[model samples]
Target: MLANPATALELDHVSRHFDGRAVLSDISLSIPAGKITCLLGQSGCGKSTLLRIISGVDRPDPGGRVLVGGTEVAGPGRFVEPEDRRIGFMFQDYALFPHLSVADNLAFGLRHLSRPERRERVAKVVERIGLGHLLDRYPHSLSGGEQQRVALARALAPRPSILLMDEPFSNLDQGLRERVRRETVDILRETGTTAIMVTHDPQEALAVGDMIVLMRAGRIEQVGTPFEIYDRPCSAYAAEFMGPCNRLTGLWSQGRIETPIGAFRADLDMPDGALALACIRPQALSIGPDGQGISARVMAKTFTGESEQIDIMVHPLAQTLRMHSHVRIPMGIGDKVSLQLNGAQVHVFPEEPGTDDPLDQS
Candidate 1:
């Protein structure tokens, strides 16, 4: 299939309200052409709602605008229907027609074209997606992954400018989900399709997205490449949302924050003697020889195939600290070990008011 010229998407203060409550608030984002941009956040963070507004499935509130390829699709006194916007939408369920065969389903959107043109379009998409063998099969006869590919082919058959996927791989099992998700990303890249995918999984966003837009409670929390969002989160909420972190409450003093483990350099702006929170990822902690760092006793160990998660009870803190080790540690439960922190991975942020313990939030 010939690659469609990718179109960039722009949202200008796009806000959506329902029954006097705001679902999306002041969302202004510029999605680059021919790249996968993942809309990442927890459930009800307005990721899907924002996608709907951009696709013309729903409308934004007054004064908000949505532009596609430098043309306003939705704004004050101007609105384009979803079909007229030339956008392809792949739903969470794949949404393949139950009665139609694979080939017919792929050609469903090409009804306006001549019969030969529709057949040629479907053939091109099927060949590109390697779905030729399943052309005669029905939706009920296909596996989850096959159904997903069919839905993708159907969406791409019309050669839309941009593709919008909402939790595309949520239906597949863990193993199949990983493989299918990778294949889907490869196809998108191969076709040079500009895509905006909504997913609640941080790992999915980190793995497949060229750019990640982290959303929170109807607002964009952070936007950057996967590394930036993971390494240099803008806030405590952003830090924890991307991955699990061992949060510690401490007092900022003399350009450093003193915690239960030790004093870490405070890179954030905080007044002297003010409360701050330190976010340390499990991968940042390592096991070293006794007396080299803070003393801790191994409370539990979980083997996760790629790495072993060790829970250690620190003397200064009431809760246990979790650490991930790729190499098998010659340590057992109740064994005393020294825990060393990688200073580069320790992030400090101003503590949220009314929260005594940073770990207690959420």
Candidate 2:
């Protein structure tokens, strides 16, 4: 088995510019060793650029530094080549040589070793990754999942101190993607490999990452564990990016925000009359029989296999409110229903200028 120790990574004021436009802005982050860190954001958000910088495939602008295992690899005065950084990168397309057999691909990076040592290393990695049976197969003959496994094995065969994956499972089908993702995570944990993955999928990051770094417009939006990022997002943009949210405008009064649904407890340093915005997830609203909670009329329902999305028109609110429930909601259009809010999932933020007014969809 590969025995290289996992390496911790650090980025100090890492910024990148293309054509004089800032693509990465003063990014400073510390990624712990032997843990999976996900750089998550939409396309053009600079996540892939950051990954490239870390792998030494791209350079950061001046005044920026990249370090691995506490040793500087890239900075103003010094730079390390990609090959010399001891890093392995798994591309989104699983870039395997078409003409090379699986075994040869695994041995490609072992050219520094003698013939016997190269064979021994390939044998060990093949055995560890359970690809011995397919050693003679070419890349075109392998299935997508099989090719992914081969790519992973090839990357790990080098026993890199750090591994980088760029949307590594995007090409697989949904079912296959989940299965391969699980397997990939298991292998990384078993090997104690420090890995950084760049992906735009929030669910993927939440499912696999030990730490999630959310980015937007070339800036880090939030960095936290999955639960922390999902449940306690630092900004409204961060909150909505993680999942669907119902935005409600309200008045902040005496440690709570009073909205059309009802008063919700929120500890914010705002004046009593300050305008506040409440973000509630669809799952946080519970539908019950009339007279139990805030009365509303069911306006629409959408069946999504595992769950039902119910849209209700609260009496005092101009726009309909949406809630999700796993159980079937029996209410038809115009049927009276009650909506109860779960305080834990309701997040309040100070309303800013130009923020959308929930009631004004015109």
lDDT per residue (tens digit) for residues 1-362 in model 1: 22223548889999999999999999999899999999998887899999999899899999999888888899999999999998999999999999999988998999999999998899899899999999999999999999999999998889988899999999999999999999999999999998999998889999999999998879999999999999999988888888889988999998899998989996666789999989899988998767878898899999999999999999879999999999999999888999898988888998886533212324
Write candidate 2's Cα lDDT for 1-362 as tens digits.
22223548889999999999999999999888899999998878899999999999999999999988888899989899999999999999999999999999999998998999999988987887789889999999999999999999989988998999999999999999999999999999999999999988888999999999999879999999999999999877778778888989899999999998888887688999999989899999988899999888899999999999999998778889899999888889889988898888988888877743222213
**Residue-pair clashes, model 1:** 0
**Span of ten consecutive residues with least summed lDDT in model 2:** 353-362
List TM-scores for all candidates, in order.
Answer: 0.95, 0.94
Candidate 2, position 84, lDDT: 94
Best by TM-score: 1
Candidate 2: where are CA atoms >4 Å away? 1-7, 354-362
For each candidate, what is the lDDT?
0.90, 0.90
